[model samples]
Target: MESEINKSPKASAFTLIVAFVCVALVGLALVPLLPVKLNPSRTLPGFTVRFSMPGTSARVVEMTATSKLEAMLARVKGIRGIYSTSGNGWGSISVNLDKHVDAAVARFEASTIIRQTWPELPDGVSYPYIQMQSPGQGSQSPFMTFTINAPATPVLIQRYAEEHIKTRLAQLSGIYKINLSGATPMEWRLEYDSEQLRTLGISTDDIREAVRLHYQKEFMGTYDVEQGASDRQWIRLALVPESESRDFDAGRIQVKMKDGRMIGLNELVKVSRVEEQPQSYYRINGLNSVYLSVVAEETANQLALSKEVKAYMDGIRSQLPAGYEIHTGYDATEFIREELNRIYLRTGVTVAILLLFVLLITFSPEYLFLIVVSLSVNIAIAVIFYYAFGLEMQLYSLAGITVSLNLVIDNTIVMSDHYLRCGNRKVFMSVLAATLTTIGALVIIFFLDEKIRLNLQDFAAVVIINLGVSLLVALFFVPSLIDKIGLERRKRISPSKPKLKL
Candidate 1:
């Protein structure tokens, strides 16, 4: 009766083992398919709308332009607070959105409202502007920028960037948007002749009016119908310089002065297509250069994106000037790759040592196989879960997986150690109790842990999964395997005749 008391079921361990292998394989396959990124920038997306009325008073711009745009954007979605800087003839409308709102959506909504309001503004006043809330855009987006400065001509830099670099950099997958900031290459520079106008008895205001007439012939005001809403409309009147090539000289324009004076406006001022550059300068390696910045997209895979970016750069080496070179201010690609590899290597070593220790203690190869199967399956489940949730394989997340190494071995130890000690029915019941107790504790830990944002929580999650699966394997399969296995080392009983002879 005692011999048969150690009742173990049929060979179901093999079936569970097969299921574990299938699950593990599926999970491992899901890793590369996940959207991975190396976003180390702590900065969030935020921008403001900027409009300027150059040479005009700040007060005038504020009262007429700034106030109206502010009121309009205030009606658009996603507005936290509005802060403005009314300097000289420029005003900026800073806006912050709720965390849930996407920045791109915010920009679109703001732009649409501004377009509808453009008709109401004075001719010289610009349309209400909206730009991203970038705190240190130079540092954040580009990681590095080189300003191509030509002593007086900056437009060449702008032209070169537009014609050459901007599009090339945009091809890099990880980069979000590349923007050129410094003085761009210019085509037209029309200067007002101060002295020639004085001789003509025409004030500067007269010349300004002449140029204004060239752009706008008949003012088109908004039309309002009876018992209906007003319609914003613009009726084109004059053909200003349609293209940069069309020079605004005295020969082309007919100027009607404020007084009885009549003159060819071109004769009063010099209107020639001179290379015009912005006043701002860009510097790289202590030399002035054209500045271009590269930003990362939402789903940019940092490691792969960088590798592709470098490849693309290599392909365009002939495109860059002899003195020009690429540099990085915020390349987290190499760092992330290194961290991931480190974790992978560590995991490999830890797993090897762990299996070796477990095998040595059990002196059983079969149990070792079970340990490997359970762990592999456990990790596979976690990876699949992550991919299904659309979670990126970030460094912190990988860190969580690596840190789980120690805990992953716990279930295997419990199951294998108990199986070897299960001499009979009492031993089997005790093993079951031990397994249940360990499982209960793991469940408690799983619910209590909450650092899911980083490596800690991820590690815990994997551990909990691995242990739970291991316990299930132990309960449903390992006991049966133990009973059938180790059959050669059975207990030997002496016959009743042997006791009588003694």
Candidate 2:
């Protein structure tokens, strides 16, 4: 191949151009389709179980919710450890799996176990929030935060957020979760005089029963009538009362006394709207506020997602009531973009230094151009490999690209220098030896089972692919250019014969 290329330098140059054009075509096509993310968490095999039972004590939560969940999760396959948290009104369990476990399979198994144990939980506990999560990347952090500052009560803000803001935000694409803080959930409050209740022979339990009887929906089977021989229909029947009131304070409830006298609930208790105890308190710049923390999906572009969210918020701001304003806060994408910018700046500086050093050594424009071409081709090809493998571009992967840049430049400089000294015949052999030695050291990283290696395989993969491309460019493309451009022949100064002594 070398001799043939040496015989027809133009053919070699054409081959190199065609090869790079093919790489460029692939790179351009795949670049837009590649998934972009701020940061990618290295997920391990694990699952989390969350349970909430309002008004329950920690002891009850532990014995009834946590213990039963742990017992069920223990039966899951590849169980390495079980850790749980039992708190007032809530319980959580984390089941860790062996390193060899498949995350998806573990999730399925854990979900099955949760389904089996869900029925065993005591009455009053809400359905358990069961999910699979990686220990390393358990859940993504909030992508953006905004504070709703309004001249309104906490209950009012909570209602508005739930009814208006939350509903709007949930409609946006790529949003995973929207967490509200400093706003209390709506709950019915009943304040009663102890003496009045005692005189009426009524308890809080009686009042609760009355409310449940009025509010609870009941299924009453169906009412069916035959309309025609081929068309008989049944109307579903439900115990829905048209006169039921939504406002708790509007009308009086009736309670039958033990002695057959009836009393109005208004005479016994006062119903009012109030904040729940341990209410969430959110304040920004010393103003009453409700904080919204928006988390984005794992595969989303944090920067682009934030922009879309900002635009939506802006569009809706004019519709807000007087004295209500939305204050944008802590955008996580800024940090991610900042980190990327730093990497880019460092890479630019490294390239500048490499170019300056090469100029000082070779002082030839042709050699400089060849070096740039070789480096660009190899790095571009490396990027194609990154997207081809379904890897999300992240901090570690960017770092790998930075390192790959230096390796490609190194290979280019060495082979270019070798060609300027020796002929093209020796350039390929020398570059092959150097490239093989560098690649051999990285081969072990792909096989290691250590945590760091698992987290860094994308980095190693980038490096290896770039190295391989660098070898191709150094062995073929660079040599072909040097021979075709006739830049490999360094001008030799023939010693002039000393003038005959005359």
Candidate 3:
């Protein structure tokens, strides 16, 4: 095998050049297409369940929603822990699953149990809202956030976002969730006059019961009636408006008066459309603002999504109302990009310092040049294999590359030093043994369970590939290149003793 490997660089150097060219082309092409992310996903498999019980105390919320939901979800397979929070009129439960659980399967199982448990909930409890927090995105911040600052009222800004901005941005491919802060919910407000109510002998409960019975809209149920000889027709019942406004059926609604006469709702109460009581307020730079928080899909490119959002904002700038401006805030993509740039800068500085030290010890520019070339080719090959192995270019993989660079430089120096002292055979054998030892340790990491493997596999792949490539370069390419450059070991002359004529 050694003889066969030796003949390639000597007998046919062009073959090596051709091979290098092919790899270089493939490496450059794959780099751009490689999926880049900030970091590896560390979030365990889990999901969140939320519900609201309006006008209920925290203890009531816990009993009605949080505790029941937690009990139901605790039966799911691979559940690790159950956490619940109950606040005034709101309850939430978070179920953390064991790492061995498949995320998709866990979601399905959890949903099934939650749906089965829904009917058992107490009256006035809201339908459970299930949000699937992806294993990869559980800890992610919003990819981009935009604050709508307008000279108009917060209500107007919120209306603009809800009616105009939310739907448009949701249509973008990468955007999944858009949260609006400081936007009041649209609701119908009914104001009752106490004196008028007392004069009419009517109570608020009586009016509420009347509205609940006759004024609201619903698909009460479907009725099947015989339409013809054998066929049946289904009819759906829905409340239709008899008044100009669709708020309620004011005409059909009648409440029994104390005198036994039928009275209409128009006489006892005033109805108007208004914003619901706000639970929270938001302000940006001392001005009332409506904030639109945009989150990208799990596998989506954050930087690309951010750019698209910015472009969309630019296109709609002119359409915004006068004195209104969209201020960008907390762009996470830009932050990740900066972090990556810093990592790159640090890697370059590290390489330069290492090379300087190697140059001082070797005292040969030729050796330095060979080491640099070997380092470059070793990394390029590692990148090529990284794509081949179907790993992404995330922060973890980049970190692996940085570490591999140091290892490659170290191996190259070892080979060069040995070659100068003892010849090519010693260089090949020593480097091969070192590379095997390192790869053996990394291979052991692959045997770990799925939970551990997901985080480490890409990193291990990168280092192993780099070390393998370094070994090959040390054995073949470096030897051929140094010989071609006519670099040889210089002879050292011992100090000559003074010749004294006795």
Candidate 4:
């Protein structure tokens, strides 16, 4: 390889330049494809289980549901701690796992334990919902919040938002979750007449039991019937009794009295369907409103997702009914956009400063141009690495790239100077040693705890990749370019001393 290169340095230089140019082109193409976010997404070493038991007190929920779940979850391996909270009619348990444990495996085991313990829970308790608790999930604000205001009732506004706004936004890509609130659900309310109940000698507990039993359906055994006399074929039919209907008719229900008399429930209690009082209220400009909170997927590009959501909302704005309006409650993407703009500005300024410094030091356009090309190729290679590693163009990663710019310039200058002053072998060894030392320090990030590693890994990886690429460019491309441009020969040639005329 050495003899071949010495024989045809131009061909070798051309090949190297073309290869790097192609790499730079490919990296530029991937710029738009990179996923951009405000920060790195990290899954913490924890899992949460939430459950609810309507109409049950917190104490009852703790005793019957939360306690059992915590006890069962504790038996799973790699668990560090189990924390629980019991609220009115609801409960939650958070399980923290050891840093070295595989999150997916731990989640599966925890889920299995929860399912096994489910049957032991009270009948009123709902199924336990398991979810991985990512870092900052509890305090992280929604990506976007939209409020709906109108002249209509809160229920009407909520229904419209649910059917139109929420559903439409959810259909867009990158939407992870949507939550709608600020409206009350409708429920059947029953008012009992004390005098009629006393006269019928029926107690409230009896009425409750009767109502509960009325809704219970019973399934009888299947019956087989002969379809045809000649063929003697039989068809089996399932038997089920229709015990209750969704529509509540007062006369259809009956309460048994202490005197052994059955009376229509309408005589003792009046039933009406009405909207329940709102548990939580939302208001905008002194008017009741409904709002939707949208959360994007962790790996999603926030800028793109935000734009898509806003465009969709604008497209539907005209379709809303008269007096109905959609207002932006809060937009997290605005901050992200501003931060990105700042990063871009800082990057441009940094590149400019580095170029000026290179010119001042080298005073030769050839060296300056070589450094520029090296920087470009180094950055392009780093971008390719980012895409390969599934790293996001976020704050931390961008910061990494920005900080690595200085190092890229440094490597190029060092290699070019040494190559001109010394030769290929010594410069190559020097650059290689420097690059390896920097990488060795960065490799320590991978050995840290998983939580810390996840947060810092992207930064370390970007720096390491940039440095490695810079090394390669400094060793191969820079020297080849120097030989092609004859810069080394120019520097080595000394001006001939003029003959003195005595």
Candidate 5:
């Protein structure tokens, strides 16, 4: 009755019960919404910008496409960092946020930035593009491509990989972006009539100059100016502007003579379009083969996605060219999942150590009930954070959760130990007041210290919630149960009083 009377004045008793129930419901309801992605970090939306310029080497790409894209992208808001890479005929740019940003918003922002800045960029650059989705989901590479070269007809091998194998693999789940490298067919060529060229005294170098002059852009140098701390420069180039870059006329090109006479290039050589050299070169199992890589949708589960991809690959082996097969494979999902699992294992070990230490010090299993309740409180609250933040159980958040368990248990130990030390009802009231006071004093430490608050926010929050729960559990629930029911049955050790020949 005394406990009931004390509890009536404090609304915490009822509020705590209501909070626990509501939070429990929230936590349970959110389970279905958690993304099943193999890499939890991959679910956060992002966009990749890609550009390619044929005949332009890597260094040229750095100066032309990468520079222009980077300069223009600098102004976009919410950008955490800009990453750029350039290779022969290709350049890729990635902008990422430290925190999860809305994917649609990031894509739209990135696309608009690329689009508006295109005209100011150097020529020969293909239109900038943003990847609509990432390929190869879960823990496996979505595509594994090995090339088979038969000296007989490499073209047939390439055509088979494309018309049959690629088409088939595209149908698999979480698989997209199937790229085939080093498979272009050999080109048929027509050499210029050197005898006719000699009759006209036209040199081969002149023929090459004529061919290049009609098609390619020639870069001019940059103009530099001094700024307060740096020098700025703008490069200039004359281009066969978009509309004229496709000009492929054979009649207008010339073969120049030593005597200054000229003859049309078409008159000396039969000009026709044939296949160009293969763009990519690859080998597998000591045999000539093309490379194929498959990527997956970012939101897909890595483990499940990899599993499905492997299953499809195994099933489709018979469909591949007899001599051709998947030679190499790699999966990002598997690596990330393994890392998350490690974090989880560490979390379990840390919690176990904390529980054992608390139980040992108390020398009472009943006291452990508080620690159990505290850990549960944290788990329940972690679910709330998961929903509020859309935090996938990423390795980073897992680390936070592990630290939080210790905090929740720590706070409970402080509160319950105080309750245990109280000798009388007045002492109980004093100890309870003291417990709340000590909590208040220590609570500020979680927030007041930046490192502690940031690194341990999860643990701190769990402790906070658990602390509140522990108090209410003690003041109302524990007290009511203890008073109305009775003290826990204690093990009877043989009376110590002069144990006479017992």
Candidate 6:
């Protein structure tokens, strides 16, 4: 077998090298397509449903909205426990699902149940809103926050952010939610003077009725109009003309007094457009501002998503008015990017040190070259598997690849040493057996508890793939290439010269 392999060394070496090169090229092509995440994808085991009733006390909210929702949601399959909290004007119900339950199915059932029970809730209670508990939901922060500063009012800034920035960001894929803070809505304030109202014999209710009538449009039936000949048509009639309804004039509204006298509404009440007090406050550089918080989807690639968002913000900045500015308050992706870069730097340093050590010990550039080729081919094969198995390029998996580099070096050393000495099929069999044993040990990880298994699965997979590919490279490609280049023969002959001279 050794003689036959040596006879066609050029052919064998060329074929194997081309095959490995193709594999490397394909793997490099797929590297960019694999998702980059901080951790593996895992479904969270629960979800929350929130409802609100403005101006209602906590006790009333519990009795009316919280209790009813908990009872109705309890019927959902695979529910492990139902927890609830009721506060002033609001309540929330948390449904914890069993580990084996499908989260999607549970969410669908819960939504359907909430809609069915909507009519049973109190009159003022809001429709129950449901949100799935994504991974890290408890401690997840917004990936990006931006403060908008403008010379205009808060209401105007809020409107611009909503209509332009928020709308466009929401349309982007992988954006889970966008929240606006320091948002003040435009409101019409009606100030009434108590003494003036008393003197005019007009009450607040009278003013309210007059204002309502001023904006209200009533359909007062239709008028039968005679057209050409005997043909007749019905014309729709409205209490307020279209022209008058388009513009609001408080002076045109008249309120009836206690003495049956009509007075202008402006005489007793002042109507003015004003900004409502903001629910939340945001400040940048000690100046009041409106800010937006952008949350990423559960499975989104944070680094990629952040890049897209920054590009979008750049475009928005160019179009903003002179006095408007967008300032980034926080960028969470920066940390992730730095962390990944650190890992990459560590991997590169490890490879460099290993190569240096190999060159020092062996003093054989040929052997060092073999080790490099083996490492590269194994890594390429592992990358292909990562893409095929839906593994992410994260901390754990990168650590696995880094550790596997040492294993690749070890396997290459053993194979190269044995091939130079024995050069037989036994070299392949022994290395194959050792590699299989290592894989067997790692396979037990899959049977462990779910939480542990999910965390370590990617790491184990990366190591195992590298080990298997390394074995194939060591057994077939390494020995054939050694024969092709006459490295083995040169080493043996060189050592024999000293013995012959003695």
- Whose lDDT is greatest here? 4
lDDT of each: 0.56, 0.69, 0.70, 0.74, 0.55, 0.73
Regions of candidate 4 where Cα sits further than 4 Å from its true position: 1-11, 52-72, 85-91, 98-128, 133-141, 185-277, 423-425, 484-502
Clashing residue pairs for model 6: none
Count backbone clashes in candidate 6: 0
List residue ranges in candidate 5 displaced over 4 A: 1-33, 36-49, 55-125, 130-276, 288-299, 317-321, 373-381, 384-389, 418-502
Candidate 3 residue runs with Cα over 4 Å from true position:
2-11, 55-60, 98-108, 119-124, 134-141, 153-159, 162-181, 186-277, 285-287, 297-301, 304-308, 311-319, 419-426, 444-454, 486-502
* Per-residue lDDT of candidate 4, residues 94-145 (tens digit): 8888767777888788767865786587765655767676453432447799
* RMSD of each candidate relative to the true structure: 11.3, 11.6, 10.7, 11.4, 12.5, 12.4
Query: Is 2 or 3 the stronger prediction by TM-score?
Result: 3
Where does the lowest 10-residue lDDT sum fall in candidate 5? 219-228
Candidate 6 lDDT, tens digit per residue, 1-502? Answer: 5455334344566788778778888998887767666655654478888876767999999888899899999999987788999999789998878777888899889878876787577665655667686443422458799999987777778888888899888978888888887865444455656667778787654665566456652221111111324342211122222221244466898899999989886666556654543546666666568989998765577788889999999999999878889999898778778877887899889888989998898787877787787778778877888888877667788788888888888888888777776555456666777888988999999888666786788889989988988887886777766766646564674434335554
Residue pairs with colliding backbones in model 2 are none
Candidate 2 runs further than 4 Å off: 1-10, 18-22, 25-33, 53-68, 87-89, 99-127, 134-140, 153-182, 186-279, 285-288, 450-453, 483-502
Residue-level error in angstroms, candidate 2, position 265: 23
Estimate the TM-score for candidate 1.
0.55
What's the C-alpha lDDT at position 219 in model 1? Answer: 23
488, model 6: CA deviation in Å? 4.5
Judged by lDDT against the true structure, how good is candidate 4? 0.74
* Per-residue C-alpha lDDT of model 5 across residues 353-414, encoded as one tens digit per residue: 87888778757666666557545654665576565744444444555466546545554455
For 1-502, candidate 2 gives per-residue lDDT tens digits of 6575334345566687678757867876666555556666566567787766767999999998899889888887888789999998888988877778888887777766765675576755644655676644526678799888887876677678778888898998888888887865433445566566667687654654454345542211111111334452211111222111445541556666667787776666555543444524776666678888998876666667888899989977989988888988888778788988999999999998989888887677777787887777776676687777766667877788898788788888887667656555456666667778888887878777645675687777777888888887776677677765545343332234589886
For TM-score, candidate 2 versus 4, the one ahead is: 4
The alpha-carbon lDDT assigned to residue 274 of candidate 4 equals 60
Model 3, residue 458: what's the lDDT? 80
Clashes of 2: 0
